[model samples]
Target: MPTHYVYLGLGSNVEREIHIDMALSMLEEHIDPLRRSPIYESASIDPRQSPFYNLVVGGSTDLSLAELNAWIKDIELLHGRTSSTQRFIPLDIDILLFDDLAGLHEGIELPRAEILDRAFVLYPLQQLAPHLKHPGLGISFAELWRQLQPGPQLSSVRYPFGVSSFALTVQAGRFPLPGDPCQLAAI
Candidate 1:
């Protein structure tokens, strides 16, 4: 199967650190060299809830979009995420972008709506793939981040996971694509 590049959003307000770490490990097991953005913390969009740590993960995967969506939902359910609960979620994983795909696929909107409306999603996405253009908007994520209206304040922070290298955080320039030959692991 051809590799399909993807970007996924991960967030958790309850057991934030633990859930995020476990989600990272699970994603790495599947997404290969999962490239991540610095985790950003902000007040939960749902005013009744606590703050949330959010980040975006990118990599190439061989699974079809439907298969990938099923896998993500499974992970969320395993962590106690349910439609009936919103005040405290164990984990929430959203597929932000899948290659240059746009519109609805696998019943999930591509380039997730939050990428355009929420600072938490766009900021981390820009860090991970600064030059990647939104498949539908045709604007680079970096530019989108710059144009975003002032909203929730975001602060980048390190998750206190015992293992720092559990996931690769994109610190400078652009992270590698499927085969850009970057020093970072691509598998």
Candidate 2:
């Protein structure tokens, strides 16, 4: 089996920590040598009641794009996520990149458009794979991150659970949530 490098974006607002931890655990089980960016707390994109915890995970997988998509969907549903539920998102996961693949495949847009537009997505992705080129844009993720306009407020959070390969550090100081100006570039 051939392995392809894959990056996944994860976020949660409801029981933020618990949901993110759950997703990470599931991903670790499915993907090997998982590399995760430090967790970040950001305001929800949609006007919502709670803030969200966001991060990006990268690893190598032998599964095809469609298989991986289905696997992630199943993990979300297993964690109580449903398309019909709107008010609170328990967990949300998106495929950000798949070995430089472009165009549409398995009903997903390659190098997810959000990566170019959202600070939450771009920052963590750059943290994990700065030199990797965006399949559609042909620019490195780090450069794309530098070019994005102001986006949602994001603050680094000390994720409690430890994945063996990742180091978790707690930053001292309370970051004001939402409506406060916090940019990853400054961190």
lDDT winner: 1
lDDT of 2 by residue, 28-125 (tens): 87689899998888887767558888999999999889889999999889888898457688998999989888988878889798998998899999
Candidate 1's residue-wise lDDT over 65-177, tens digit each?
Answer: 99999999999999989874668988999999998888888788887898998999999889889999999989999999999999899976655454333344344345546
lDDT of each: 0.84, 0.82
Q: Estimate each model's TM-score.
A: 0.84, 0.84
Which window of 10 residues has the lowest lDDT sum in candidate 2? Answer: 163-172
> What is the lDDT, from 0 to 100, of the residue 150 in candidate 2?
91
Q: Could you tell me which 10 consecutive residues in candidate 1 have the lowest summed lDDT?
A: 163-172
| lDDT measured at residue 91 in model 2 versus the true structure, 0 to 100 | 90
